[model samples]
Target: MTELDKKINQHFGGKVVRKDLTKLVKGNAIVPTYVLEYLLGQYCATDDEETIYQGVETVKNIISKHFVHRDEAQMIKSTVREKGTHRIIDKIAVKLNDRKDQYEASFANLGLNKIPIGDSVIKEHKKLLSSGVWCILSLAYYPSDEKDASPWIIENIKPIQVSNVDIDEYKDIRKKFSKEEWIDLLMQSIGLNPKEFTLRSKLLQLTRLVPFVENNYNLIELGPKGTGKSHIYSEMSPHGILISGGEVSKAKLFVNNSSGEIGLVGYWDVVAYDEFAGKTKKSDRGLVDIMKNYMANKSFSRGTQVYGASASMVFVGNTDHSVPHMIKHSNLFDALPKDYYDTAFLDRMHAYVPGWEVQKLRNEMFSSDYGFIVDYLAEILKGLRKDDKTNEYAKYFKLSDSITTRDKTSIAKTFAGLLKVIYPHGELNEQEAKELLDFSIENRKRVKQQLQKMDETFEEVDFSYERISDGKRTVIETLEVLEYGVPATKKTLISDESSVKSEGKNVAEDVPFELEGGQKIIRDNQKGISYDMLLGAYLIGATDIKIIDPYVRLPYQLRNFMEFAKLVTEKKEPGVEVKLHLVTNNNEDYVENAKEAFEQMAYSLEALGILFSYEFDENIHDRSIIMNNDWKIILGRGLDIWQKTGAGTILTNMCKNNDCAKHVK
Candidate 1:
């Protein structure tokens, strides 16, 4: 086995089984995802393929012989009627029919419902019924030919629990696996190869599965189409049900007002809405309203009574405009239907997974390393929902007072999900904790920022906090504050390779960023940095600062940087070098080659007669780059900081430095 396979085996060996894979691997009899995974748990939980195959056949045999299908549902019923007994394999969900003394059971896929179950089924299966656990039931369907078809058979309806492949014991094993081996193993789990995706991208790719292990999570991802946004919710779990727009209703979701029938949310752990975004896609206003309440409060109203549910709500939609366009024009909610623009419903969202951040779907991202059979993970997540692990991170670090309680809850939910998914053993080293925390804050912050753009009335609150070594409380304005160790991110991005995507890309453009070296530009400090630094102290009150940066193919980045300089030096004396020198990178590949050309361009800076020269170096084999005088720009990756370069990129301003400002005749 590969090293990653070893680590994966060590960590997740007994915890999960990939039941969806059984058919492909062994051509064994097809079975429900939950049942196959359950049987695999007994013999194939190890990383050994030999054992997995053996286990696959074993599970298939169990299903083929024991599991019942719809075509035979009546046959089994007849057999029971004739013999006065029957034993059949199937999954059963029981509901307490308080109106009567018995529990009503439904056999999913068997086309059976409201069957009055034996008292023994009610007593022994009460917890599983209330929670709706997945089980392989030996049901005896009987009807008397006279009064009943026949007598019922008796047998144990055993519930199978798939132990997750053990991930906890594999901690040390992880250190030995090269990123490649680790990736390949993960790919193998998903039945893919590592060569198809980069390690960072692979992890980013895995983030979607996290919700399987987290209950009541609300995550939204919006970007260009074909990023596989609905892949997991649509295919990953038997317990997860995906509903197209037309499939959703009061009866299908929450509680049915008609017969008091509980809906999808009552039965499934995750209920997702596919093709969720549309300017005019009509939906029951009542559904959305109650959904909003249930999402936030986890309870739905029936008449005057409230019923609790734990289903996580997932909404998947396609956007016509790109992320940059939306950020420049309306913010993240730009493409959302008018009704969904409600801040009240949006606020309940835990994180906005920047769908735009992900690249278009690639064939190589699937993992082969053993991952938890999504159903097993679902059960674990549901089990954890009963526990309050949200505040576990808070004990080590606290949120700034500026963040609202709602923000805290959203962040905590995201954080709690991460903890359960990757660190369920609770052995998070400090680095691990921060990764989860930073991710949590960003998701909450994304929702908050979009809210502000939609309606500026919403106050901007910091979603970050500081952890003082001295144990003193420090309130930070943004995540930057938390990363820099001194209640700020000022010294962070430069020193920390992990801090690049701080706050977000669009908002950061307005801020003065201290590039690699200590050369600080006074940009928009409103969000990230000080305007004083991005713009020299002298330019503040000045009418204009002649800005020049040739490589700003992304109209937003260049102009925003220039205008930021103007904002910092707005009060500068006239004719000062307040005139900016953004010595452009003239190559047609400016955006791609922009960073490479910075060093060559930096050499041309002395003649620009500008105090500040924004260098674009896409290539230079060094950690250090020169700045005029004592100031030098030191970057982790140099000018090749951002991923793309395009003229229409969202960088807007009011002066020549601003985007459209220069276009005006």
Candidate 2:
């Protein structure tokens, strides 16, 4: 176990289980992750390898014996009948048989329906009245023959989830971990490796949890397939349900007028629609209208009766075209069905997570470390829904006046959801609050910007905030806007200075390259930057340059140095030699390799009419570049600033073969 894993075990003992165990014990059973983890939590919530191994085997045995599979339903039924009574784990939903004045249970995987159930059981687990709940129950067969009589009997049932959690204790324990550590812990709980995601990417993953904790908070994410957009809603929590986008109706989602029963929104905390995109997919216009009203008002009316529900809405889909293609030819919501393309319905969304920014899943991305069993976390989130942290940002900053009330509400709900996820204890500094505020504004801004492109009446508003401490205003922009909508004069292409319009109507050319000396604060997960755009203007006319960085001994660090050197060569006059020197820290392990690499770089650069030299400084810590042309550039991360693309290459400005701008600030 790593140090973080050990710390997690020490602080959250018996509450956290190795996340990878869920997949290990899950063979052919189609159950939510919480059910399997609940079983594992009872046995494997320990760091000891021997205990974990034993626990995994025990859980596997339980699953093999008790968990119902559709293909083996008849066999299990026979076993139950022969044994008189048998314990089984299956998804069970209850519905009131009004005519008989009794409740009936339907076992989803066991393939049994209309089994008589106790009234007390229905009262205890009311959620069973809506979508099915995974439960461990006893089934008996009486083999009786009577008019309108059923032999199947359910003796007892227990929902498969953490029964209860001391939310106060959970909040108090949260104080032990730092912000980054807590974020990593949450990431692991969702079966993701924190090391594989940038801070921005981590926030995007956490944003999916917002709908679970915030009432009526609508969210949408559309991107390329296989990004795990619907995985969280489907597998992470029993309180949420994932359904086909094209299969919903007013009666199914709102209230069933035929039976006068409350629908899914009345039971689940979140209702996520999977595969919600495709322009040609047919949809019920009445369903869309009801959804629009419910999403905006948190209530739906049936006849003259008004019903309210707090279920947040989530829509996850795949984009048919790339982000740039959508930005050029259509809007970011181009893939949404024609009925759902209305600006009014789209405006109900509180956040638009850029699923395109998320890297596709790989084997190594699954966590092997300790994290809260998701059921425990899900319950905690459900508990947090009672507390409103929407005004948390008001302590540090005020949003711009130009932001409308509805936009502010959307931003506040998103901010509150993120705060409840990251800082549940409500302890945060100004910078932390500011980060969440900016991120919140950016997400809502993405929705609004796309709305403007789709509809003409929607006026553009400045997505900026003013700090209470110094009154400094900061404007936030979505990554897509920065990549595609930059002014023509600021275009960074060296090959073609001409700027092309989105509609291919006109072009602007001959803009002079401009540079100013000031601190450039790049937001996290920002893209559309390159070595040329970052340092070319500053390094122009520099004959003698000395780069001072403390740690550049790693192979990837050396690659960054070489890329910078190549940029320098390309920028300088073809025939004139530019002298370059490096002052970096020495490492005993890689000092020999560094010397060899520097010698090879010197040999290569000398032929290009450039002088290169290097020296190790054990005591130097500052990173900067000093040039003889009276220019000094301070480096926050040295030359290794670009983020790693999923394709295993550095993403600077844009992808090598695609138009993805991926980087961390």
Candidate 3:
């Protein structure tokens, strides 16, 4: 075991299990991760090898015997009939049978229905009444001689979830892990590899948990698909419910006046709408209005009587266009249903998670280490909903006066949720508090900025904060604004030179630049620093350029080199030919392919009055560019210093707003 694994096992003993064990025991079972983890928590929540092996066998046997599969339903039913009684694992939903004057159960996979169940079971596990809950059920088969009598009966049932958790003990033990360790543990619990994400990216993932811990906190995330946007709500928590965007109605989400019955919001702590962003999708305006009212006031009216609910709302969907395309052509909420596109409705959202920044889920991203069982973590987050730490940052920093009351409330709720997730003990210093505060402000600012684009009447506000100690005010900008060029309305009237002087920094044509040791430090995910901005000024008078980078063999790397060549041609005087030389390594597997690609590139560049030549150098490790005009520039990541723009994306052929490469400089 690695040090981190040992440390987590030592600190959170008995409450943690190896995450991969769930996948191992869940061979052909089509159940959620939490259900498998619940079983693991009962038997294999220890680090001992012998105990884990024995537990794995026991769990596998239990699943093979009890779990019902649709294809094998007939065989299992025959076995149950032959045995007279049997226990099976299935998704059992119980409902009241008015005609029979009792509750009946339905097994989703086993294809059985109207099986009589006891009242005690329904009262004990109430979730079965609303949406089906997975359970281990005892079934009895009685052959009936009467013409209309049925034979299936439910003997007993038990929902697969941890009944309760000691919130105080969970909070007390949180102090033992440092902030980094705690974040890693949470990431592992969510089945993500912590090493593959940045601190900022990890925080974005943690923001998904805000809904579970904060009452009535509304969040929306719209971006490309395959980022696991709905995974947490569906798999990680039993207290939350994930519903199809088209499957909800006023009667199902809120109270049904006809029946006088409360809907999902009254029982579930979080009601997440998945696949919620199709422009042409039909929705009831009344439902949108009611949702907006509930999100804002935490109450809704039914027959002139107001009722309150504590459920937070989450919306996750795919965007039809990229961030830049959306900002330029339409608003960020363009993919939302037409009725939900109102500024008033969007203003109620506390945070707009930038899902585009999250990397696509890959096989390597899943964790194999130890983490707290998700059921335990979910219970802890649910218990934390009663605690309020929204004003924790007030002791260290203050918001700008321009921040409105609504803006402050949104920021405070997000900050409090993050604090509950990361620092439940409230043991954060000024730096820590400031980090959370700035993140909170940026999230709210994202919502407000988009609101301004949708409605011009919405005034722009400076999202800045002042430190209590030195009285220094720092302004926060949304990531999109920094990535895309400043919007026309927000552009400053001053010239570039004056703007740099006023800000006391060196500013490039599009992005902010800092000089350290005569080298530029470009941040990851930064936009606007194109090839022209980086090498345009330096290569103005140079005729001969020598580039040395050993990794210029992949298709993307070769494409980067071609882009640099194009830039050199663009900056050269009319009819002037610039000679470019490249020194790179030749991989044994694709040596000939690399040679052909470079030769093809050379032939292509010659048409543009640029002569490109290349040579193989196996011993070259340092990457640098030498210009004949007495200039030598060092490249921290060679020419491939930008992320690959996916096919059919807005930035596919454009270099103005590509994401910065995350390789070390």
What is the C-alpha local distance difference test score of each model? 0.56, 0.84, 0.81
lDDT of 2 by residue, 131-233 (tens): 7999998888887779878888888889998967888988898899999899999999999998888787889999999998899999999999889999999
TM-score to native of every candidate shown = 0.63, 0.93, 0.77
Best of the candidates, TM-score: 2
Give the Cα-based TM-score of candidate 2 against the true structure.
0.93
Q: Identify the runs in model 3 with alpha carbons over 4 angstroms from their true place.
A: 98-101, 143-150, 487-524, 527-665
Better of 1 and 3 by lDDT: 3
Per-residue CA lDDT of candidate 3, range 171-286, in tens? 78888888988998999999988877767778889999999999999999988999999999999988899999999999889988976767889889999999999999999999
> Which model, 1 or 2, shows the larger lDDT?
2
Report the lDDT tens digits of candidate 1 across residue range 1-665: 54554566566657645434554443433344455555666667776678877876776666665566667667656665665544555666777667766666676656567766677865764534632444565555444576532234334565554444334344345455544454454445443445555433454455565566567788777667887777677555656666785567776686767667677787677777778777777667777788789988889896887999777888778877755456566676666666676888888888777666556755444444465555565455555555556887765776788889888988888888767655555556655676667667776787887788777799978555765443534222233222221223332322121233333243233244332212221111122344343324324344322333333545345444444444534454545543344533345545554554444434443244335545444442333222222322322322222323211111212222222223221
Better of 1 and 3 by TM-score: 3
User: Number of clashing residue pairs in every model?
Assistant: 78, 0, 0
**Highest lDDT scorer:** 2
